[model samples]
Target: MSTTTTDIALAPGTWAIDPTHTEVGFVTRHLMVSKVRGSFREVSGTVEVAEDITKSVVDVTAQIASVDTGNADRDTHLKSGDFFDAEQFPTMTFRSTAFDGETLTGDLTIKDVTKSVTFDVDFGGVGQDPWGNTKAGFEATATVNRKDWGLTWNAAVEGGGVLVSDKISLTIDVQLAKQA
Candidate 1:
């Protein structure tokens, strides 16, 4: 069954993303074989929960320089011109256009290129933190062509396939606290 905003008891108001608990991660195939995962450590966003849950809106921004994949070299390269070109475009943003409890459709902009993408939304429910703060959790995922956002750098592998796959899978785990 589809969930409604009321069904979750998420109060109507502006919910600010808790950066410390939120993660914006991506996974892509390497050499068309192994998968490489990376995530942005700095992300800020807000969710405007409307009385009608379907009308809720989400807006987020991630700092390109905060990308971390465990390897320092690879992380540096990702910030270079060959990839995200962090200097030219220091941030990526997402603005929601529609939300239906199960899916969220939005405009994602990277490197000045904007594309509409849809993510399957999984609500992780709401609860109170030790500080008596009201918080909600959610996980959303989507796959998109990296080239669409101008992230097309790649090299050919020794045996065959390219170094990086065109398709990039995005997974976002977010925790939001309702603002008083």
Candidate 2:
């Protein structure tokens, strides 16, 4: 389709991701003792690689209510005002502002709050499937203090750290399909 691009332009032509093959997930510490992880059940976005990504463009969006942590009670609390406030925020998003090699700076919006966040990205290279379809893969992740995102719900731990550590890690394993 002419809507997609063949040459690697500073802006990649429109590409619709296969959400079934792509994953949007995050990891956070539990009482500074172990880690807890989860993934959003819904996600969609486009990738516009104009010229090698550092100078390329990327825009991504994910539904806030789609958050799943394998626990029904916890997910509800996360949707409340104390955490994500999905009613007010609705969607959390990211749009790239700049990229320097594997390091990317972008605007991340969550719980009606927007901020610039830097994440380390790894280019896993593009390849062709057995069906001859072209695909590109990359991994991007970051660790942030939940307090900075205003998700400060926690309990005091008499032994040492709080009921939940302030630090939260976000990781995204992405697979993008190229122009057919």
Candidate 3:
């Protein structure tokens, strides 16, 4: 559906992403039977809330080296040349091109490859914290083929399938604070 002006009803201004209160996470099938989850610990971004909410813009950056999957060894490997190659590509970014109230379409970049991806957004509404700070919450998810972004390192299992599935699922829970 096309995005309407009133789809996202928010005050017209700049809304900064509160990294401390946000989570950018992902899930991937492991060994064709299980799943592995991880998240980036450091992220920062902003949303330009235009008078017409549908025209708003979103840009976000995430530190690749800050990836955590609960396993130290796995985290290290993920940063190595086999996976993200964090040393060469230290960050991944997303810039929104459109929002249809429920879906966000954007360009996602990783390892120098850029691809258009869409996320289903779940609005959590706006609220004020104890400090009286106005905040808007949203939960978004998307799925993409990891190989499209050069994240194609895998090993074959003894029984069947590869060690990692090509598809990666992304989950983003963000809280934006209205900036004065």
Which candidate comes out best when scored by TM-score? 1
User: lDDT tens string, model 2, 56-91?
Assistant: 667888888998999999888888998888998888
lDDT (CA) per prediction:
0.94, 0.76, 0.92
Comparing 1 and 3 on TM-score, the stronger one? 1
Per-model TM-score versus the true fold:
0.96, 0.86, 0.96
Scanning candidate 2 in windows of ten residues, the lowest lDDT window is 1-10
2 or 3, greater by lDDT: 3
lDDT of 1 at 148: 96
CA error at residue 50 for candidate 3, angstroms:
1.0
Model 1 alpha-carbon drift over 4 Å, by segment: 1-6
Candidates ranked, most accurate by TM-score first: 1, 3, 2
Model 2: lDDT to the true structure = 0.76
Estimate, for each residue in 1-180, the C-alpha lDDT of model 1 and write its tens digit.
455554566788999999999999999998897999999999999999988888889999999999999999999999999999999999999999998878899999999999999998888889999999999999999999999998889999898899999999999999999999
TM-score of candidate 2 relative to the true fold: 0.86
lDDT of 3 by residue, 42-114 (tens): 9999999887777889999999999999999999999999999999999999999997677889999999999
